[model samples]
Target chain A: MPTCVGVGSPPVMAQPNNYMKPVGSDTRFGAVTRVRGRIDGDGNLVVEGAVEGNISLRGDLQLAVGSEVTADIEAQDVDIEGTLDGDVSASGQVHLGPGSRVRGALRASAIIIDDGARFAGRLECDFDMPAELEERRR
Target chain B: MASTVIGVGITIEGEITTEEDVVVHGTLRGKLETKEHVSVEQGAVVEADVTSNTLMLAGTLTGNVASGERVDLQSSAKLVGNVRTARITIADGAQFKGNVEMDV
Candidate 1:
């Protein structure tokens, strides 16, 4: 007969599978849907609809093609391929794809503007100039 | 799949207006107006007034509902709101506590 360990067994403690995993939630808003408020959460968000408020997320934010947004956004990272009319502040990278029309200030560690994207905003990024460029400025 | 899907971990606290179908699996606390069907799936919670063409509820709702076509409450639904629609059906095991107004 096999002996059964009681509740106070030494090796009975096990960590959950998601113990060290980041928040892996995802939210998607499809086309033809419109929202008029604020959204703040800890998950990735994909928007293919219209939003008229502020958005703050701890994960990536994607604004798909044909979507329209009129709100400020703050996220870990951002990818925009639609129309945005608000400021964007990201802790990570921010990319404005082709055909995207953005009209606001952008502050991110790294920013990329693709060809054919229309943007009218202030860019705030930190860069280290090379030695040759530093000599030219003297 | 519905045109609009609110995932299980998301929450919205405002107004939503859609021209296509909507499915909710999270929490919403505001107003919802749509031109198509709306489904509040299981584990979802909606505390808002909903106006839609039709509604299929299997979650919890605590507000008023106005549907143009019909409203169907599944067995797992728990609703506490007044309903005004052309047709309505409440299945067994469903809990509802509100007035139902239908056209004669």
Candidate 2:
């Protein structure tokens, strides 16, 4: 899988300062790689391999297609297009993209499952119900 | 290009096994085993036993290394461990404190 987090963007001249680093500095675990431990990062992480450990990141997490992850993940945002067998806790949005196969509970601010995605888990999203639905329930 | 890259600002604590090449530019504290080459880039810090076909270090490594082919310690490398390999090269300015077991 290609480890292109933000392709076709303007090249950064210099680091300038912390928190303004370029997007290409994100971490990538390519195919044929297998990690059996815990990953803690302050940058975005893209997985295109097999991971059997927990992932905790301050940035977004992307599980590329053909990737297999069997660990719980905690990130700001999560986008999965692979096979995941663990719970996901995202402070932002959690998207199960096409070709994703997930089997775990998800807790996020918002959750989106694409049409081609296969999911077998419980969702715990925080969203306000429609006023009509709230009145009908009462 | 390396198949597995531990990029900057990332810290991995555990075991990593790969069939392809690996490049570390961050912090790794565990064991690393690879069938191909392994490179520890500059500014990286590795505290683990590394097993690979070919090992190259340009950073700080504090563990044993067993390489099948060769091991190269660049000038910017600071390694403190034993190295067992068929061939080895330690460039000038490399800070190394370990035993070398070459397979003559």
Candidate 3:
């Protein structure tokens, strides 16, 4: 909101610009929220609380540490730094940050497990055909 | 800004329990419980029973409401459900179709 210093018209008239700001695309769940159900979003999401349901996003999904989620997740990208007890599927990359503990099935195009990350259950990572591998076959 | 923000273009269908304040600019269709203030902003839609310390509504809601402290319905709001609160205020231009209980 530091942009409150607008072009001398006050913020009331800048409603259109306000709606087009970068904050319009990101959803954040603060440290006190506990949700149970299905979340459908077309943009990125940041979770710092607890959720017991399903999350499906067309963009990135980040679960901060101290957050615990017990549901299934589907997204374009995923970054986890918390505890998750459900399945996860991402069309893009998936990263498990430090201190993340997961116990469920995970599938993504690429997966990265950082140090201090703990994961249990199934993992399915699909890698595209590389030129070197294809050349060796020829 | 409120602690938990449900940005516009997002839709949630489930129960939400929070210990801090919540501001909704999107759509929520389920139960919502909070220990702190809960605000439904303009153009937002909520179809859930709400329990909170304070309630501020500026959108459309179709469910019962229970506030521990007070509840305020803004002028642009459209509410249709029962409301139970110790103190309540309804602004002009707001539409409400529900019973209010003060218990006093």
Candidate 4:
């Protein structure tokens, strides 16, 4: 190891992958009164209370377990681990984690419905229908 | 870390009541009432009535404000509203247009 100065510099940050969670604040809407309005942002947002409106973001969104939300959402990535009753449009991927209950249409490039997630919505994802199946239908 | 933060690119069009600290680096239109300190960062826009224990504003505020502790308006703050606080400090470079009610 190299010799260091007397008063050393602060610790360097780890690699991006080493940071498991997103950067922005948790933005927790604590479990109390419902939040009503349109939320638009470029940072990652996590909701734990009740919300009724539209959530539009450029980064990511996570709904914690047991939380209730009634809002249409459009984001780069979305993780649902709670109760949602609105349409979700994700540009990247949408993950419905275990124990989540969701209702409404979902459109994303990729989607995951983990085991134990209760979903009642029209799921639309990018699909490549094989030519053989198309020929059979023709 | 504050429990709630309205991120830079976010905008809220309704009321926000929290029992914890709230940082606004985005936009809020309606009302904000908290039992803790609240900071409105520079470049943010708040057109709502604000109530907090301590209020620190460095952005554009266009509503009435009531704080229990104090209200500090930074140099970059542009406020156009009434203020009802126990204590208030207006930085030299700040722009304010409101009635101050220190009696409250």
Instruction: Output the number of the lDDT-best candidate.
Output: 2
On residues A21-114, what C-alpha lDDT tens digit does candidate 2 reach at each position?
Answer: 5545678888888899999978888899999999999888889999999999999878888999999999877888778999999998767776
Candidate 3 off by > 4 Å:
A1-25, A135-138
Q: Which of the numbered candidates is closest to the native, going by highest TM-score? A: 2
Residues A13-97 of candidate 1: C-alpha lDDT, one tens digit per residue: 1222333333333577879889999887666778999999999887778899999999999987788889999999998767888
Tens digits of per-residue lDDT for model 1 on B10-104?
A: 68889999898888877889999999999998899999999999999999999999999999999999999999999999999999999999878
| iRMSD (Å), candidate 4 | 3.1
For model 1, the local distance difference test gives: 0.84
Winner by DockQ: 2
Q: Write the per-residue lDDT of candidate 2 for residues B59-80, one digit (tens) a residue.
A: 9999999999999999999999
Q: Sort by TM-score, best first: what order? A: 2, 3, 4, 1
Q: Give the least accurate 10-residue stretch of model 1 chain B, judged by summed lDDT.
A: B1-10
What lDDT score belongs to each candidate, Candidate 1 first? 0.84, 0.87, 0.84, 0.81
Give me the displacement of residue A31 in model 1, in angstroms: 2.6
Q: What share of the true interface contacts does candidate 2 keep?
A: 0.79
Residue runs of model 2 more than 4 Å from their true location after superposition? A1-23, A130-138
Candidate 2's error at A11, in angstroms? 24
**Each candidate's fnat, in order?**
0.64, 0.79, 0.79, 0.54
Better of 2 and 4 by DockQ: 2
Residue A79 deviation, candidate 4, in Å?
0.3
